[model samples]
Target: MAHLAACAPLGACTTKQNASLRSQSARVVPRAHHADGETQAASPALTRRGALAAGIAAASLVLDAQESGAVGFKKELKDKRRGRTRIPEEEYTKELQDGVKYVDLEEGTGEVVKKGTKVTAHYDAFFRGIDASSSRQARFLNENINLPEPYDFAAGSEIRISKSKELPLPPQALTIGVIGMKPGGKRMLLVPADPWGYGDKGYAEVPPGATIEVLIELLSIGEA
Candidate 1:
């Protein structure tokens, strides 16, 4: 059941996508904004040609984007072996041996990752990687490798970019990547499935595909 067995994994790598991520036409949407940074808000939604390239995919930000929430991003610090946590045990065992499949969702207050830290996250990335349905599945598929990045990514399996079953997506809605990391610093990224737009061969809202989610952060370096 590891998917991609032969059929329905990506439906034989289907093709017929005329362009996704919200049908682009080529930047120029901004209209206002200029007070502190001194004018810069033409808002083609902050351009790069809209979501990367706009069709099939161009932005989901990170690129296994399977480390989201309820593993709940936390905060608090002090250390010797264990005494503070907002997620820190060598950054939670280097995010579970860098395979992205760990979930300990409780037992906090033992943070200690010195260097000038700052972290903030609220994620959701599930099309079929298992974040709920509790039975005994926790190795680190809680998804969120910083959300928002696009410029021609192509939405094959889980890099989908379909969003618009009529327009109704607002579940903790995400965005806020690149801040400051270097105080015991660590950074991991992925999530570029074209703005989590699921579509290309994926159905049932988000399955038949699943890839994007791996946002790890542990900054303290230059504090900004």
Candidate 2:
């Protein structure tokens, strides 16, 4: 896989808001597999937001995770092209339960990530659209423009929301999204705009109620 890099503090992209709106909640509903081995499920209620108080609490949790060695990253890439493991095309596209959909691009070889596990990875996020041009060439919200180096953070840590016009969603979404992944594994997450992403009032670049497609590559996982 190719790598891109840009120099900017992660905090610069997030924002804090004072409100009591409920944060989106999703449960890992398991579904039975068909002969094709695909997982399927009905959609759940979706809303995205983090109360200012919750944001502060989540930040505290991140610091504790870091101190416990639950979050960290590598400065270099061992193998950029071929990750540690790979998943089959059909298997990667299997149907998912709940509203969130995921396709495992690479099946990693490291330990499965748990709640407190520290993780290192590179992510490319874009707004999904139906129009050909919008869908095919959507701009990336966050990506490594030049280097392969990955960012380190706790799997369940809550970072501040992006400062861009986009409203902040719950930080746990990333944690829940990457739970079963191992180091070197890559997955594409189709996050519903409602509860999992920006709600009615979309960000400056993304429209209201637009689904967000996030390509996450797990570089490494550390001990808790």
Among the numbered candidates, top lDDT falls to 2
Per-residue lDDT, model 1, residue 118, is: 34
Which regions in candidate 2 have their CA more than 4 angstroms from the true location? 1-98, 129-149, 161-172
Q: For candidate 1, what's the RMSD?
A: 33.2
Report the lDDT tens digits of candidate 2 across residue range 1-224: 11223227753432321111112112345354568977665333321133556788999999898866532322222233222233323444643435767887789896998877888766655553221111112234554323233456677666354467233233224555677898888777666775655567776456787766656778788886
Model 1 per-residue lDDT tens digits across residues 51-117: 5567325334332142333222421111211212233324433232123332333222335322223
Q: Which ten residues in a row have the lowest lDDT in candidate 1?
A: 75-84
User: Which ten contiguous residues of candidate 2 have the minimum total lDDT?
Assistant: 16-25
Give the number of the best model, judged by TM-score.
2
| Model 2 residue 68 lDDT score | 61
Q: How far out, in Å, is residue 24 in model 2? A: 98
lDDT score, candidate 1, position 25:
28
